[model samples]
Target: MLILSLGRAGDMNRNMLMALVAIAPLCGCQTSNQADYMQIGYGPSFDVAHAQCEMQKGSVDQGYIAIGSPGFVAGAGIGNALGNLAAEDQYMKNCLILSGWKRAPHGQGAAAASAVAAGTPPTPYGIQRAPGSWINTALLDWSDANNKCVAGDKAACGTRAKLGARLRAAGVNPAPV
Candidate 1:
């Protein structure tokens, strides 16, 4: 027979919160570029840049982990460890910018609102496909499935097939993955 006081539970919760805050910086925080937090204008090759950055960062993180275990001294110093953990952040941002991302105006693509006010349908954004949303989804699905195929992830491939079918239904025949 045991009874826990509410005060004790509150104290336990407070202690847990403090512990999490203390360890926030030390955890395996995903390396990200400042640009990742920003909403940039349209970019045709955004997916390619994003994919490259993610692939490179993942490799960097995995390599560091594999080479820097508890007893390993390869990544000994704090600066070196942090560097290894975030080596690709800047590279990713640069890649994205180079891929045509730009700082968009605050009221980006206000044409839709203006068109509505004038009682006209707004044209699609420049460089964006018209009524091709399914193509984008299918492309993304195919890319993910292709990446996971070697890892024996058949589910992702099935998703790609479904998305491809949707694309075909939408009048854009996607190539088989």
Candidate 2:
């Protein structure tokens, strides 16, 4: 049974590779980080927010799974991967909005938008506006409190708990420190 399962796994991998090679030509275009979302006159600030969103969301690797023989496996995996890409795009959009970005108007290019007055939106839920920039204040406080808590500071632990709850109340999910 083990030997048979190994043989099947090898065959499935081979099929997946073949499927990828077949579609390689069609996927020649590389994915771009340049999205349609834009904040007017937020040149450097926009770059900063985009980087933060990318870091928080990270990258999703959608794999093509092959089950049966190559002949029996249709392009189901490719379709699934495409669906996942759509979902990932949505997630990125949500992250950008949550990070305080707005979509550019239709037919309005980034250059045109930047030429207009700055339209920086209010700081989002857990972030605080600093001198000339915005910062993740809640995350910073949480980190500090977490460090103190790890060092046996009971009050710091309570502070960390309160910060976490506050962030959750504001619709910000604070990951474990």
Candidate 3:
């Protein structure tokens, strides 16, 4: 029997580390514009609108697998995955807009942090809901009205008051804006 032993395990470890370093940029490199969205509908809320949008398009993960297979052979699997996810995200955004869902003025950092803390899926250029947070459609209207009012639109000041009153009725204090 002939026995062969690879000499110097440290060399193997070093090579592995180098390989990881080379591919570090490829892992989880999907860039996304995280934000909050809201919709006003007595029947279909933001969640329903999101689901309907998703149903119209193929799954983002499914595209990743299909594109990633050939991309890996070409040494661009992660890049391809990012491209696929971005495309899906754009499609979803368009669909939501058509469905009457609009991006909220509020920032997403706090919501994303809360969602992450609650063990929800990380945002990856798709429809992700914030945990324990409800989308107030009046809040969105109030934000738009606030912006217009600030821009010297006198009509918007009246609209802002109407929207703010709705928020107050729901026990949500609209910030000074």
Best by TM-score: 2
- Write model 1 residue lDDT over 26-119, tens digit each, in one string: 7666544322332233444434656765676544442322232322222233334466555655566566666544333445435443553586
- For each candidate in the order shown, give its overall lDDT on alpha carbons: 0.50, 0.57, 0.57
Off by over 4 Å in 3: 1-35, 40-43, 59-74, 108-177
Whole-model lDDT, model 3: 0.57
How close to the true structure is residue 10 of candidate 2, measured as C-alpha lDDT? 72
TM-score of each: 0.29, 0.42, 0.35
Task: Give the runs in model 2 whose Cα sits over 4 Å from its true position.
Answer: 1-18, 21-35, 40-44, 58-66, 71-74, 116-177
Residue pairs clashing, model 3: none
**Shift of residue 146 alpha carbon in model 2, Å:** 40
Off by over 4 Å in 1: 1-28, 31-48, 58-77, 102-177
Mark the 10 consecutive residues where model 2 has the least summed lDDT.
Answer: 126-135
With candidate 1 superimposed using the best TM-score fit, by how many Å does residue 127's alpha carbon deviate from the native? 16
lDDT (Cα) of model 2: 0.57
